[model samples]
Target: MTLPGITPYDGKTLPQSKAVSATNVHEARTALGNRLRELRQLAGQTGKQLAESLSWQPSKVSKIENGKQTPSAEDIKDWTRITNSTSQATALLASLRTLETQHAEWQRILKGGIRPRQNALAELDQKTRLFRVFEATVIPGLLQTSEYARARFAESIRVFKLANDINEAVEARLKRQDIFYRSDKRFHFVLTEAALRFRLCSPEVMLGQLDRLMSLSALPNVKLGIIGFETQYTASPWHGFWLYDDDKVLVETFSAGLNLAQPQEIALYATVFEELASVASYGRSARGIINRVIADLSPDDAEA
Candidate 1:
């Protein structure tokens, strides 16, 4: 599974398509601003008049209406009440929530620890019918063993200075793996050779994790592909991303998790996934790559 004329990854940061996340966020804000402006106009109030009624600066009203500023919950409530459109408050707040979800800072999201975040993702897992995952550095969560997941969670707690909920978070993540058994769902995972060789966990734990991957790959609904170091990739695996059906692309950065739902963003990720998958080894070839990594980890056993 190799393609000619495509450049291999040069171990540099490839230009990403994630800029669309910011664009979509701005567009959503502008639409929300337009709705608030319409409400004010229908109430026969000028921007100055409304700002005066709410005891806010006139420029504040203008900024919110032009999407230059985000309105707080209190601001939304006061604006709706003053405009005599309190009925729109609920809908408006829902839109605000959607905006907040698009770019969640890791600190704010993990304030309560990682268990809640795992539960939230579990809910999403329940709804997604097709999952297309590509990983460049570490194994995807669904296929990780409990020991490996614990190591990952412990690192998160240490980095974020978060409370030690490593045990609970590990349990929740393992529970999410239950979705792999569902016959109605489908999963396609592509991983770079680095994911298999990375020493994120101890050798014993990684050995167990590699065994888990070998078993999971045999599931009828699961298709696992590995891009070995020898293969030339058609697309540079800039970063890992999860595509949920055709609806959303979830990207985890160093500071924030970006939830991209714009059609173009989803399409771009889908195209990249296909290109990576094209050069990946599946079935026996994929197993051979995993076995080589496993043997490298346990040279004594290999010699025996």
Candidate 2:
């Protein structure tokens, strides 16, 4: 019922932060609208005058100031110009961009080829000093072998009817693994036992990926944890999440990806990861669980 990081075991969204207003997209939009209204009033422009001057319908201006619609980037730039509040424009635009990007629909973000998405990840990947990943569906992309990655991308292509740009996308993802070799970075990965049972790839490919996981487990800077199926967890493994140090957390859903940057929101994911990690076994014990999953994929398993 739970996805891992987003849902509780009871299938509810956990209210992680006390300062929800700071991160709520709706609130951000409304605040921007109210601020615009205040600025318009300060400029001594009535709705009709401002709309006429800006070549906008009165209703469009009214809706924007009433928080019924979000302003486009260009609209905000021009709004500041019309209000003569150029000094505060940068900060306002930055907040607006953050709000929009955080709530961006996956369809819109993926309107271009998958390669761009993969490349965008590379931008964030290289700058990350610490990577903490929790997965409940399949192997984390950073830890997946090339064959395993291709299989996953194929499913994506089918779902989105995207161009068969699998080669470039996979290659870009593979390039991100370079971070795995960097001694300056640290990675902590945790996976639920259920993730191992998902057969996203052929048995041979999954086995190979499992082997790569074991090898990565031995890395001095990497810590891999596998929570056994029987283990009693301290907290729910709700949804898959990635924490980039203490600064950001990325939570993906069926519809969109959430970029949680508020300090409190990031801290909440860090806390959930810790709770999950506490129940997960590492070192040789973690490898033992992975080996069992590898064995489960044997031809004999199909017969049984």
Candidate 3:
């Protein structure tokens, strides 16, 4: 998301919002890095001296200085303190605020087309070794069959008045499942019983999706759990979230997707996932819940 420009502590205005695109974030980041280094030099402190004072590894300092990593507000404050230019703290914070609020609006992301977005997800899927997911409403993308996924994409496109990229987007999303066969990766999915009955697809398609879950649950690296309505729970399923390992959490809200990366935010999501997982049924019990949903749709269908 593009943020408005904020005045730095020095009174010179920097349009950090202009730096929000994928191309410019780097340049803006590098600019901040340069300013940080210049401050250190002005303090007559060497790289090693500053690293020692901050009690950080030399590599950590080097990464932020080279724009290989983004520095936290605390890191910026410490850097300014060491330089005795505590005033620079405000300017650095202004830049940091823009850097932190990187919300990619759905319109902007899908404006290019959904196929590209699917390709982007494929890249991230390949890198993630562990995927922890919880969905209370719609079916998680990774678990959706091509038919189910196509229906979903078609509805979304119509709602958003987007381009007709459903065919290519579904093809791209299916490729993401290639990671499913890799023995090196692991997946944990916790879905509420209501998700299976969401009515996003026809009875046949939803049944097929439930069958897919049953089969995927048996995989050695995949742990699929279903939380039944009968299960007691203290927390509300406010939003669906996917934790990509422990590094990040992707939350789907009504307005937009939230990308949470701060350590505290990640920890909070971890706790929520763990708590929800505790109330979920796994293996045969999980399949039973899915089977019941299918049976409710079609009394003769027992194929789950």
Candidate 4:
């Protein structure tokens, strides 16, 4: 598919210049769509005209411009030629290709064995200055208790057949949280209520995990929000993402994670985050939700 030229939809507004590289693939795709569309409209070219010039299907052109499909390198080159914007097209296409490759499935990472990939997580931990996370499924590694983490890690090792260095894997994840304590850095966490109710581990482990989340919420540098299920709006429909300053967005999937480094995509993600944040309860209200759960876990109230 080639990059199409159509006006950006309402959701595709560009983010601030600083966050250009800190968005997800879907966000980048939207940004690219908007830019290509702008270029095409400037050239007074319709989707069909652009497609005819590039010898691509009109539907393909539409998909590219609409952010539904990724354009190949060859497709990008031809598109630039057709639009007579070679210089800008070359650089943009190169970046687009990078984004496309980064979205490869997690199975590929597993092909190289899970250890190396886990090590990469360690490296990322050392570099990121600020972490803004929205989790829908599980407790973030930074907030997960040891018992909960161990259970989750054990499952990962078993699934991936990664029997060696389990401790190293666990340690890498735990160590990543140390950034939360660094004076120069801060963490903003927004979690859906489902994450708390979902039982990734046993009741006792889950309770401890909730307790850990409560403690983290109390930290001065942390801004924690818990979005209730009954909330009216959510930026994301299902799934969540991690924004690391203006550098990148780590969009986690079941099999693998997508690292977004384009500015446009970063802005879209930021927008979504703002939407999700708006529907969330922060400060005392947020803490009260967790506190109620903790109270439910008390000795006499074990049934809950």
How do the predictions measure up, each by TM-score?
0.75, 0.75, 0.67, 0.66
Off by over 4 Å in 1: 1-22, 26-95, 299-304
lDDT of 1 by residue, 49-75 (tens): 999999999999999999988787899
Tens digits of per-residue lDDT for model 3, 2-58: 233422322232223222123345556687888999999999998899999999998
What lDDT score is found at residue 274 in candidate 1? 88
Question: Each candidate: RMSD to true structure?
Answer: 6.8, 5.9, 14.3, 8.2
Runs in model 3 lying further than 4 Å from the true structure: 1-101, 299-304
Residue 210, candidate 4: alpha-carbon lDDT: 88
Q: Which ten residues in a row have the lowest lDDT in candidate 1?
A: 1-10
lDDT of model number 2:
0.82
**Model 1, residue 73: displacement in angstroms?**
4.4
| lDDT per residue as tens, model 4, 125-219 | 67877778888888887787767878877777777675555566667667777777778878888998888888778878888888788788888
lDDT of 2 at 31: 86
Model 4 CA deviation exceeding 4 Å by range:
1-101, 111-115, 295-304
lDDT of 2 by residue, 265-285 (tens): 676677778888988999889
